[model samples]
Target chain A: MLNTEALAGVRYRENDVRVFEELVRRYDRKLYNVALRLTGNPDEAKDLAQEALLRAYRGFSRFQLGTSFEKWLFRIASNLYIDRLRKQRNVRFESLDEPVPTASGQVEKALPDWSNNPEDVAEQNELADEIQAALQSLPINYRLAVILYDLEGFSYEEISGILRCSIGTVRSRIHRGRRLLREKLAPYVKPAAAAGARW
Target chain B: MTCEKAMSLMSAYLDKELGFDEFRQVELHLAYCEACSQEYESLKATKELLGTLRAADLPREFWPELRERLGAVAAEERVAPARAKFASSARQSSSRQPRWRGILRPASGGGGGSLFSSPMAKALVPAFLVLVLAALPMVWSTRRRPAEAQVSSRIDSIEPYFRDYVISEYDRPLSDKTSVGFVVTGQAVTMYTSDLLGPSSKVTRASGLREASPLPPNTAGNEYTLISYPR
Candidate 1:
């Protein structure tokens, strides 16, 4: 269980070390899941999650008393993942202005489209690898936005706080991130499957 | 709304982030435009696909390793401040001021006061001072100065081994010439010197060793002396 009081009392030492350990353990599963989705590898995810937790513990002094611990932890995980990507990003060049290829073997300036119905996609019958590959294909920021919103079920406001951006920017990132992800997952999804999703 | 504009907002529309007027605009537009409607549907589908990526269980051994690493981190954070504080307080004790004063000492030289200064820096400075004082005992322990018993008479001017002791302990460079001078006035021992630069040599107050030995009664207030240790 997450010892909220112990975390709140981070400045105080009377709280047993076991309490802090329990606090980290409580959020381990969630952070691991979010990290796994972001990195697409279990080993990398584990490393990212551990680093995020360690950073959070060190920086606990700045954390306010009443704020959401989960969101704070998520911000650390997301930022670490983004920071790692940024270091490696300079090695290769990818211009978002350039056209992205579509499932139809065509090229366009904007994100591509998925032929499958939204209902069918949400049904959860596909292999995990298909979704993992699609997520990894997205640019780091876009991948984070989508993962935070859909995978972690964070509110736009919470994501804005985590990413340290305006709500409008969060909305735009989530929108664009989902669009690109849909384009990537289009091939894995089936068309003409009784499109239950309407605009 | 036009197809391009409506499609741009389709993502927000699916997210229900649109306000009343914008939502109405998107709703009215999506009611008629099949392309915009299809885009919104597919966009939602892509985001939903992420929900299916399940979290895998970590190996049992990983937890123990992580816990051990965390313990190490905790120990470091705990020891760092305490070490710096104790060293700083000890250093402050050697000075004429009461040891308690060091704890309440102003962190900044300016009138900004200690309250506004960094708590961490304030805590560590005194601890660092303590390490500086350790040179006196270290010299005796290492037997660097065989006649070290007489070194403690004038605690202020630790000439022979202060610089070497500090450099050895801190493992850092020091100024070429470290000249510290002291004058005993009644019960108050006043140590005064400013960026006094001279060639490295054993120097006393009057000429060389004049001020170092007992001062002559005739020497007036105008006469200032320094103890200079050769580097």
Candidate 2:
């Protein structure tokens, strides 16, 4: 069972390591989901999610009581992801920790890497890959708004705070982003359906 | 409402961001308008398709690894003076001003003076002072330097009028020529030599070379100094 109060209590510890672990256990999945949608790389998303959690833990004393912990956590994740993207200046998803494995089972030497894990379920894998490819094809701003709203289920207001845009602008970006995504998925989606896949 | 108008606002309406009257209008139109309804459904379907794109989960080992890395970092942070250094600076800053301004307020009022009245106003005062103190020298220099083009234009216009005049020759007994200097007394003594000296470094005219010397008592002897200094 998830007890946010207990988690909050743990997070409030001056420097208690166990409390931080519990905090990590609580939001790791959700943050990972949001990061994956934003970045569209499993390894980068994992690292980014971890980074967000670690940052939150470091600054946990600032967390407001009686408000949505999830929202606060989400804000941290979204901000970190946006900052990382800005710093990279058009580069995407090359993890410092893990690299693409080559023929000799050694990591490939490259700047911005695009690699897929072979272990995921095939249909889920296809959906994930197509989603990533389609996401990358969209403009970065549109991609951020759409991912924050539809996939991660952030409200327009929350997304505005996270993306630092007016609610009206956030709505329009999500709408336009969805339109472009639908057009991009049309070809890939129809072929998959024709092969008897439901998604 | 027409399909275009309804379609245009469907995104806002779906997001529940429409103003009350706009929302009502959309609801009323959607009750009877099949075309608009179909368009809304299509847009809704598009959103659903988008929702299928999920963030990939990290491996089971990933969090543990991150925890280890962060633990090491936290341990290092514990021993390092970086936090202490920041805290000391923060203490000095806070001591210099009030502390309540750091707290979050619902409405940070636009009446600028009210910000200082804030409980945290003391802290903000020091921070603000620090910023101003840091900026003062830069601001002073920026204000002190005359605009280059304006000075250049003034020089260009003033130069031609006086370029022809010169002391024909300093012919006299050395004592008489030395005694020929005037002793003009006024607040401003040393003038810009460039005003009289042409760009070629020749003293073409000395119109404002005081009829009487304004030279102070310490340097009352030599009066032939016409050095050009930059503005």
Candidate 3:
């Protein structure tokens, strides 16, 4: 169809170095922000994003135009951060997101009903700080999965490619990561005003 | 599904990565289970709250700094492959010539008025040439290291690695239908540089050699190992 974004993709693939700046301009800010949040260091985030772009440039010819460039870029950038995290060994690897039985045949989180009022979860600004802190506390695998799923709104399939793991793993990481975040931020949440406030 | 199952699937429900059966079970349970419903709400709230933590307020220096760095990287990328290519070509030219004669004649009693009549004359000529060939790569590497380093300052940047390159040239009379001359040497330094270092580092890098480049294991000072490829 020769759409504009495709043309840009094609231009990029053709070694049109000029087009590189435009792609960088278009994506660098957004990518840099995500990387900063992921790595929790602005300087590291900048380097991460820059490395991703450099890699993307080198491999652009292999990138097909019909697919999503944003996803491709994120896959590269997120994977770099993921690889770095894996190296530090601070991230404890967890299970697949699938429901599973223990050797004792008991599935964790099988019966679920636990709730308290959370609408007064503090002001947005206050909550934002707490959430960031909470995110920083979780292991890198969980953190990346949860943030990519919730904050960035990527699908399980997309995240699988980004993480280079099975979809089951993505699900598990998101759940576990979110569990850790809730545990960290639970103190900041206000008591329920009413029984039916649900949220 | 029990409350445990429903709870386990809560993230899947939120993410929509669940299968239909599992999705329906979680949803049906959420409607009836007050606790699970409320928990879901809180999780949802957390997701929403994080959305507010938008892009950091970048310093005015961020973009300028990034742009300048990218420009430098771009310039390096443009030049590195060309230099690597030139190096490869120079090495190839040296390799195409016969070297066995150099080795054999050094010890042979070909002492004559032709070139090697006196012992001093014979010894000095080979010794001097050996000095040049030995020093050639070291000098070449020293001159080239700074520039190569400039291109791939970052560890992960695509520095091109060249390895086990074989170059051949044959000169045959028009009357002869058969191949005449060939030179193949086993010991050669291989260099591995990622493609990003230069404009055509990847494209121009020689590939499909019979052997995987068993180059220097460490790429520190990509110059020293690569400079030897020409010899």
Candidate 1 CAPRI level: acceptable
**C-alpha positional error of residue B181 in candidate 1 after TM-score superposition, expressed in Å:** 61
**Global Cα lDDT for candidate 2:** 0.64
Instruction: Score every model by TM-score.
Output: 0.57, 0.51, 0.54
At residue A136, candidate 3 shows an lDDT of 82
Local accuracy of candidate 3 as per-residue lDDT tens digits, A33-75: 7787787777888788878877776677677777777778888
Tell me model 1's lDDT, rounded to 2 decimals: 0.69
Q: For residues B45-162, write the lDDT of model 1, one tens digit per residue.
A: 6656666666678656667777777777888878888999999998776776876666566655664655425778778878888988987688666785444334434543554354
Error of 3 at B65 (Å): 2.0
Worst 10 residues of 1 chain B by lDDT: B163-172
| Candidate 3 wrongly placed segments (more than 4 Å) | A1-17, A58-68, A83-125, A190-199, B57-59, B98-231
Give the Å error, residue A124, model 2.
Answer: 5.7
What value does the lDDT take at residue A177 in candidate 3? 82
DockQ of 3: 0.17
Docking class of 2: incorrect
Give the clashing pairs for model 1: B87-B126, B87-B127, B88-B126, B88-B127, B91-B130, B204-B208, B205-B211, B205-B225, B206-B211
Candidate order (TM-score) = 1, 3, 2
Model 2 lDDT tens row, A1-199: 3455666666323565666676557667767877777776778888888888788777766877666667777788878887887899876656666766878787746565355754456555786677777887878789888777777777888888766689888878887877687788765433221211212
